[model samples]
Target: MTKATLQRRPLVKQILANADDNLLVIGGLGSSNWDITEAGDRPLNMPMWGGMGAPVGMGLGLALAQPSRRVLVITGDGDMLMSLGSLATVATQQPDNLAICVLDNEKFGETGNQATHTSPRNNGPTDSGAGTDLAMVARGCGIADTGTVREASQVAQLVKDLRAAKGPIFRLVKVMVEKLEFVMPPQDGAHLKDRFRQALLGHP
Candidate 1:
């Protein structure tokens, strides 16, 4: 996204500015980019653990935990597909203020471009992505509203609209490829964790 656009738009900035202690990011392996990782005031990237598709569930839990605040999820297409069933749960609960931002690169950057359901060009089974319409999936899951965005400039505004939302909305940002790859040292766990904590303070 940052790559194709040539600039870091307001993906996390808008959310953080509007955040009233109610937003958490669940980034997939591909989400380790500094733009998304360090952007949120309360930024959160799910650990490189299995069940990559579970971030929505975690976001849902937070929304359910504190209904008064808004909750946003910055996840990838591959991560969201692992537990697609959870979307039904999200729809079933229909928690207001739960907005999910899916950066649909069509490939899983985390696992060396593992094909996600939303992949536009699937080479084979292993490289084949879901090839499904994620926006439609979100609609089927009972999202309040959904759209596919191409330009990076729309990111901030899209998130702002979601923040003001009264129901669960989803935005599918169609990015060509990852603009940048984050290179973290092997064992910076403790230090990086603290850095992430500080990143959260930048949010509203």
Candidate 2:
């Protein structure tokens, strides 16, 4: 976590720059929801308001439902940790169009910048002295296409994999913890869902 240099906002923007009708994005709760909104709040982008660990699951379902389209789940480390088991389900399903990109700031951003499990711990009397590796977890859960992006230089390849890669891709992007403005989407969940349905389908 200490060695991370990439900023989340720009990285997120890069990921969604080429988003077309064929792409469906699920932004995880908290900072990622705002990050995706800042990138561009399109109908194809479903930014969660309160669901902490449901983005990946939603992405999986969407990918299954729309096999021809690409489904990307952009989530935070905190949210990912809450439902690491979902990775196993995704791997089991093996959706070719589903990709998960975890924005690991190593902190629980919404609940005050508290250290998440992904944050490195010191060998102190009260600490475990170990940090969880999410990419390893994904690999262990049967996902072959998994990687961690710590430096800005590696983002280009990561973006390629995210946008145009094969089935069940998992990536962890280590981002810096900084206070950024919240660029919110529509506050109403039903309204957002209905709009998304109307856009993706011909009716809501």
TM-score of each: 0.72, 0.96
- Cα lDDT for residue 124, candidate 2: 54
- Among these predictions, the greatest TM-score belongs to 2
Q: Which candidate's lDDT is highest?
A: 2
Per-residue lDDT tens digits for candidate 1, residues 1-204, read: 133441333455555564543455555444533445456423343333344666688778877876876667767777777777888898999988788877776777766776666755457657654468788888987775888777756766776666777768887777656546553322354554565456554532
Deviating ranges (above 4 Å) for candidate 2: 123-128
TM-score of 2: 0.96
**Local distance difference test, candidate 2:** 0.93
Show pairs that collide, candidate 1. 41-200, 41-203, 53-79, 115-129, 116-129, 116-130, 117-130, 117-131
Clashing pairs in 2: none
